[model samples]
Target: MTTTGTEIPGPAGLPLLGSMLDLKRDSLGTYLHAQREHGDVVRITAGPPGLRVEIYGVFSAEGAQQVLATESANFRKDNPFYEEVRQSFGNGLLTSQDTDYLRQRRLVQPLFTRRRVDGYAASITDETSAMLATWRNAPDATVDVAAETTRLTLRAVARILFGVDVESAVDVVQRSFPIIGEYTLTRGYSPANFPRSWPTPANRRATAAMDELYAECDRIIEKRRADGDAAMGEDLLTLLTHAESDEDTPLDASEVRDQVLVFLLAGHETTATSLAFALHLLARHPEEQTRAREEVVRVLADGRVPGAADLDALPYLTKVLKEAMRLYPAGPVVGRQAVAASEIDGHTIPAGATVVVAPWVTHRHPRYWDEPERFDPERFTPEREKARPRYAWFPFGGGPRACIGQHFSMLESVLALAMILQEYELEAVDVEVPVSTGITLRAAGPARCVLRPVGRGTGPA
Candidate 1:
């Protein structure tokens, strides 16, 4: 892993401040610009000399693979962002490492198998239908696609995860998560900040939010346990309460709470981002929308809700989703801390340096994608996909720590899209929605869409 190499190239910065101001201004743009100007492996330094922070950027597909997969162990989640997430949300799958991560992954893996996740498709269908029903009552048949999808995903994931206690969990999640997410981002990036113990307004708000969130999860878990519902159904909360591995013990109450928080955060936000952007992109491109709708009609004829089995039957629609994710990855940037000095794409990344594998930039790598800005689902056709490197289009991440709920995410997205397009024809009211990253990619403005019921001959009535 070690090889002598030239010093990395990067943007020159003002004394003491380094590139801090540039990153603070626009993190996404700074990453993209750095790649375009300094090549794949660039050094990004911030802060003054005594407290300097250096980030190593890995933009190539090959380098991304190395950081996230090939040499994954060496690039641990020891970065400030991950630490911030752990402090705000407990150390569940997204933040845990070493043996703790392996143990948690083993216990949680069976719950996310294709068969188990597919069983929740009915929940996704019910939620999507409910959302569409509200759309029918919208004035002028228009809606904010981002806001609606966020509600849809939140309700669906909450229902599946909390079962009978869904209502209690949903309210807490809706009210609390945004506060914690914003607080984490602010503190995660700043080199120095007021301690969480300080009675600062932001600290107090974040603490209160976390307290409410934790209390709700604990109450739900207690109810699930006392009711002896672990054997009554296979809901995620129930499964996690009794989750076990061949040689490991079941998770305790605190551990269960951590896992629940992770699922609540990961399950809803990422899928909502994909769905919102997918519909927005489709509305802007009528031809692609028509093509996708045609596929949806053939697969779910008579407005039948798509189940897990139906996913494979709707290839074109799936491709459309893939393209949407490529353009707007939910987790735009992933960070890790290098455990040792290692050469990546001919540049040496020193030990303890913060390393970034930004899907936002890699997904648009000029060498891999032709007209990377264009929305073209055809690029994902089996033939075209086979020609590209695996890391070139990783939206859910990669390697052993890849997103566990990936299957569930795909199932939920495809089913929702199919159900929506089956009944409504969409036209974009706002084509270019501004986007920025928080815990996941977020729309900076309204992505409005006007919906018209599909003509009888065009789709199921």
Candidate 2:
């Protein structure tokens, strides 16, 4: 239990390049190998040969708890890596640190209240129903479930949270989001790349995409403001514009813009990716899929769409989603920089060092999960969950910095899954979909599935 930096063991990387190549080539595999070789906490060098960066990989639930909860204050999000995110997303809640983050959290917390989120359930089901209608028109074609889910979630977020129809902007978002995400990841991970200020082709393309995104945000805000009180619905944009702190200070225009942008990106992307993975898993496991469908049918026997109140009754759907995230958490890795020297599991964490808590690794840690690699929804059953440490299954992360849209994401996911299952049965065209990780975890390519209409043979009435 002694605190000694050198006491912690890790692979001695190749000279100069160190582990940077391994990280660039396969970050997940690199972390997994480190965990297998050097226990829970392992150090690895990143960055370039001349300016290598050292980061400690924490792979155990206890270590995750330490970094994300108990010793959270000693760690801060003010790292060089987050600068990339800040450039694109601004100082929104996701990338803000310290007092600024605290203030923003308080200002926005009211928007995610259970009452507010519950109100969006109908919109979620309606959006899914609309998407299903489109799917039904071409039931026999090989549909890209991943792309379709992304579209569904984006539409729901835009309408439910912004109170505006973004049907036209969907194509813009679909084209820009991936480029922006990939660019941000490159800058964050490989700092040696051309400076963002450089007018390189890739940089120019990313900048153009970002500009288009910001312009759309402005358009939404301007349109809402033009509508005056009539547009002042309970949507997130209204809440952000009208929000005030205890001292009665309101957020500035720039602040509102940043917040909206963050919500637009984060609120939709993570949920969409998770849903795609969930559907992919279900398609591969027919028994699990049938069990989930039965639960949906039993609850909604009258053929009504699922609402927030129906959530509790849909236990298996929740488990299937939970298990899907366990295998492929939307946010696979979470990072923090040690603000001060600390000790975790007896290893000395020096001040200013990067501390990583990867759910991708911890969720699969052999010590915590039984048959770690297997897809088993039973792992999330209440009794089983109660038996494990709280941090053992943190797909949404832990602590104050956890996702603000967790409840919203869960409701959207559950409702969408239920509605889709009730209408159509999906068969996997390719069960072996590979994962690609950048800002979030996603299927490397389209998760193709052949859709078959339920016995009704038509769209929902």
Candidate 3:
């Protein structure tokens, strides 16, 4: 984020409060509306931080990209929001910066690389098949599509990454993840300043829950070590072990524990949420679902199962997934803190200013997209997609700080949906799915839908 001249008119950032109140209320919609009214490059003078902050939401994507990439030297990834997360997770990649981030990414990147993840694609297919078979989608048999999607992704990740069964840890992981992931609510209280050991019941429970989850991870790592199969396939744990050994800089057990914590928290949940939203969007727009089913039908030719080879053949499947992400983005926004003064589009941002670039805002900005609210996957066709700005649909973010798991996530979501489209129809029927945003957005209630078994063989050209 950069600074401006003396005449940059800003919205009414509440005195001693800043835009936090407005942000707290409706996060995405409210912020974008403010941007539309107060020009794109608006600053909120946060009284708490006592600094003039810049927002590049409805403005230019270039500004957001600059903050995330080129001009990133003046900013840090671990913002105020991350300070409270320290108790739950130590210095892991999600909140780490610079060298720590580079090291952790190097260690964790391989686990999700194309070649390695393909080795586990069969497990993904199997997991999706099993989940679909279990849900017969009767008229009254309400299913929380969000929860089920998370459960499936979690199970597949656990099995493929750490060689564990997510079923055994489902309740524990699910409950713990969302509670702690409520970053907007928890950002105000720092563990160092306002410790959860105090009387705040919700905070106390969340901290304890995170501790237990980490303890479980430690036990899993211990068992894996004891089993002494370091030569196992290029799974996450295996990659960590091998990478450290290869560099002759072995990560101690605690560090390995941290990686596991971050990887499980970051890698699995977000992808699951994206998949859930993908299904939800598909359910709402039957035409896309029909197209997906048709593609699946065409692909299952000659007993060839849906594998890595067929991953890219389903162009419509990829388009539908991308469109869903634009509507219901998983990582709604990215935040940063300035280490020094910066300037962008004539906006003056002081040092120590808190900055936010909301993808939810950019994805829906009317100036950048046509029918931004419509559920239209054709917007992503090879021809039309080129007409929009790059950041207009950055579900996985962009540039150097882009999600490292993009390949893994794209592969998992497509294959999971493909497998489902091949077997069952997940039809939404008068389901009231409320939005609950956290580390990811999930349905607050059951995504009630009628399920009908499609013949195991229908899809599109």
Candidate 4:
């Protein structure tokens, strides 16, 4: 039983299907429009009769904090999208609930500490250098930064995750993730979807991709087990293999495979989205780009590639990435199911309602962000950051459920951006990158930039 407060406001919809068409047509735009038009909390209804779905949109930063942190116990990863992902992938950290989540978190926490992730910086630098080398060799001066960054982040994370087995893992991941992402998105949003056993084209493709991905991860895990201590190394896979060493029981073969699959999905995709958009944003703003490059060049004055130690020294570059993530968060909308009724902004949210905290909308809230659409890096300066609410600029979702790989993501982004800016001046060819939300945010079209080589001597340093 819950006390009734103010009636929750929302957009009126058609007779049977509410805003489903509008959402399916333009999900991000619809969310933004709802927040702007309907204050902070807006109800969105889809489906009809027995199956009507009501999604409570929490747009204010305060509301976001309540849902994700302050009243986190009231919410869990029990939404449709999470269920879709959990079924396709396994029950990893991203979708595990309660005790299972706690156990997984405890086992995996040590591997992602700042000190441990810092050790992977060399692998990141090597991969960044290789990516740059590919750009230099490309016949076309204009390259799609979105595709390039996806390839780069995937390879880098794969190498760190699989060690010697990265080669076999890379191609499968690259080819299968897009199929899986699309399938997840399409089915996750539809008010009604066909059964997997029905064997539609989409189902066949998604099923095949899932099988391929699982098979590959199992193969890698089996090989690592066969190699034993004689070939054990410091890669993520090795650490996971021994994850249970500290506890009473070890992670089983399926558990190891599930964790690896989640890592490959979350590790590469989110960071790749951030890097691509950061470069695109910089390319569009040459003055900001110049300032960022100057900072990078000055910090790495010795001309050595930036490692994890140098991350703090390049503050402006870090700000640039932060600002980009603010404008275009990779995980635009995070969903949770309410276990009990809760109040947000004087409104009573009924129990069993689906709730969403959109970083994409909250990051652009009119109250906290001045000129929310403007590209500004100074907004992230230390003094200014402290002045704002903690949840206001959450590119990574907040609370205990916050991204485990955040340090690694930042390390990869800042290092790769520094190295790339050191060698080339980027100019955008396609100024606007139309994006859509899948399992993560994705560029619907090409984000192409023309790269002009620059001399090290000519840099600000």
Candidate 5:
């Protein structure tokens, strides 16, 4: 904590081919155009014999809450981009380390606290009205609507994490969790990067689909602990079979099947890529999808859908799901490791470098946004999002290694945006096709729309 009166300045780079070839030609708009010619903090590398290390670009949200929470003992998601995603998300607790990720984040942080995610808001409004009754609209009706909002939040996180629906082996666990998001992240730092075997069809279909999805979660955790069903259905695999730690030891079956495959690959790809970028930004903003369909019929008029007392009466559908996670941010580049030799603003980051806390380049930081590539969802109301800069707006990342399904991906993205604004009306069908980052931020494909029906008394008459 000694970064005194400026003298840092290490921008203009070269090193073993630093500035990572303009960050591999346009990763989050070339690192926000080198943060407008290097300001916040910048230094790059990825050279060596392979995937080098060292990067800082903090972009102050209190310097990302002092490196993910008060310089948490000198920055650390604990190395090499969370050890290349804990080699296929095995160590789980989002790739563990220190004290085995602080004892599995305090035994799975009381099943996502906030009163157990407001008791799963009536199973996320009954799995978003059974996925808006298969979105019908007649005349050659269609609906990919981002693969049915990621199969209705992966069948409501497989009924709140294993009460049911291992859905006939979910396509061998969704074709093996995108082979850890198409590895090649900086061409893998040769711990023997394997690409030779059987023409790599995404690493031979994720080694033949995570070996039958870990033998069907090890026979449903050995028939839910041999019929004792571990104090029965409290979901989340019965709260990790009543968690324990502080030497009280528990969690074994291969560390609870790698923490249930990190809550089934981050509980259905970050709420199905934030409800498919909030239905492709409310089908290209038809006046903010008619003010989120008149606040979902002025707060579920009587057709009764969103409960948990209508999630505080839909604050404009929670600002259109926090401006569609501030324009699509499902784990957009987040890596860490510095456990020694630190120096942010003035740049050093020596000890085991490799850092990249990018929330897609600190949520479009034009020194706290203005027309930051507009899609202006009234800049997240609440007085224009308190004029920006709370870490500019991290998606689901912050302290104590954030994102333990951040409130079950924010009430499954506000119960699938109030069951698709309580039965459709999204007009404009082709505006939002921009985003590209793979392992989460989607829509380089099916964003197509057209789900009219808001007729009968035109909602909230």
Candidate 6:
């Protein structure tokens, strides 16, 4: 099973394109196919033939562990893909590596501690309830669940993380974030010789969106500064502005802006996409939906809305969400460039090559998961999970660089799903929702669902 660098097998491509076109057209399919045909350590040459980047696609949990955990120190985030990310968001935790990443991570770590994020449960539930109330008033029973969750998550993250109500900013962000993400993807896959500064239409649009986003971040920072510590409430922005590291210097204006932008983009987009997929899955499987709803009803018999305290009581809901993530992880692939030559299972990876560890592929690899394509929430039960390798189901990634906001994201998602299940039952109009693989995996089209009110007794007229 082991192979040297030159012996790695891959799909042969055209003389010039070298699989770049296939990758762009259907990245997820290409990766899945490569793993299926070429084995765990598949070599994919992308971009122009003469100027291509050879990406080592790792499809097994063992390979993933090597890249993300065991030999993680030999791998760094300074890859072609993240270069595009840094151009937009700067050296925030997501894009930074080495000392910069460690320093910034330490600065923001306090804000996301379990105790701190647990306190936001009230705000999360309130926002979810408000969103449900809006759905109740709508004339059409059918709704674009993807758009609805995006709005709900944006409002919740803004109110709880930034201590500000950014309803107006949400519209701007929703429109611009996709543009930026698409641009980043394009840049990542473009020919190694291509110049990023070229004034292409996509590049121009990406620059404009980045500028607008930065301006909004600056405005929020300035408003918080003007209000002083007295107006500072119990939100992430307050923590960021006043946070001090061992070095004793607070984050400067630029650092603050980068952190805000990174958190805003990441905090809302991933959670919204995951919730949309969860609802889509539930709609397709009425039995599972009923199970989740029954749990909600049993847990909240006192008729109080679900909150942080009720999270443990709704294990099925949590399982359903976890299963959805396993199938369609928010960040389908996490990449790192090997700073030095490394060997994964005896497959020699040369220095500076991109090592891609994709949860989308690994979570579904036949060797690790049973019925990889099936939607089974029980796969996440503690007993079942214990039987699998730690890296086999890393929706939030693994290693020290794992997502910092995972705890917060889980709490927010659980609360929202519980509240929505209590109010409406979703019926899928399209059983298969198309997926778009950009910076994150998202529903490419509207996840259209007919919302039927639950036992509250108001049926769609």
Best-to-worst TM-score order:
1, 4, 6, 2, 3, 5
> For residues 1-461, what per-residue lDDT tens digits would candidate 5 score against the true structure?
34422333334446666655655555677666666676666655444547554566566566666677778667766664456656665897887868887787788787788787778777767877766775663333446677777777777776777766457546556666666466534324433455435556766666566667788888877777776744487677767866875764777777888898788778887778877777777777678778777777877788566766566677777777777777678877676766776666556556665556677766777666676666676778777678775678888888877787776677778767777777766654556466666545666676666666666543221
Which window of ten consecutive residues has the lowest lDDT sum in model 2? 452-461
Model 4 alpha-carbon miss at residue 321, Å: 0.7
Residue-level lDDT of model 3, residues 361-381, one tens digit each, is: 777778777778788888888
Candidate 3 TM-score, C-alpha based: 0.88
Question: Model 4, 223: alpha-carbon shift in Å?
Answer: 0.9
Residue 150 miss distance in model 3 (angstroms): 1.2
Error of 1 at 414 (Å): 0.1
Candidate 1 lDDT over 164-247, as tens digits, reads 788878999999999999999999998888889999999999999999999999998888888884446868999999888788
Residue-by-residue lDDT tens digits, candidate 6, 1-461: 56766688888877777778888898888888999998888898877745777888888898898898889898888787788888877778888877777788888898889989999999899888888888876667888888888888888888875666466567668778888887787777666524657887777888899888888778877888888977668888778998878864678879987887788878888998889999999999999999999999899987688778888888998999999999989999888888888878668888888889889999899987888999999998999999998889898888888899998888999989988888888899878889988778888998988888886555562
Better of 3 and 6 by lDDT: 6
lDDT per model vs. reference: 0.91, 0.85, 0.70, 0.89, 0.68, 0.84
In model 2, which runs have C-alpha deviations exceeding 4 angstroms? 1-3, 456-461
lDDT of 2 by residue, 186-274 (tens): 78887567877889999999999999988877777777778878887877788788887885467777888888878878888899988
* CA deviation > 4 Å runs, candidate 1: 1-6, 229-231, 456-461
For candidate 1, the per-residue lDDT at 131 reads: 91
Question: What is the clash count of model 2?
Answer: 0
Of 2 and 4, the candidate ahead on TM-score is 4
Instruction: Quote the RMSD, in angstroms, for model 5.
Output: 19.1
Off by over 4 Å in 5: 1-55, 58-76, 79-90, 96-126, 130-155, 160-220, 225-254, 276-284, 287-335, 338-348, 352-356, 360-370, 376-422, 425-453
Q: After superposition, how far is residue 377 of candidate 1 from its true place, in Å?
A: 0.5
User: What C-alpha lDDT, on a 0 to 100 scale, does residue 321 get in candidate 4?
Assistant: 94
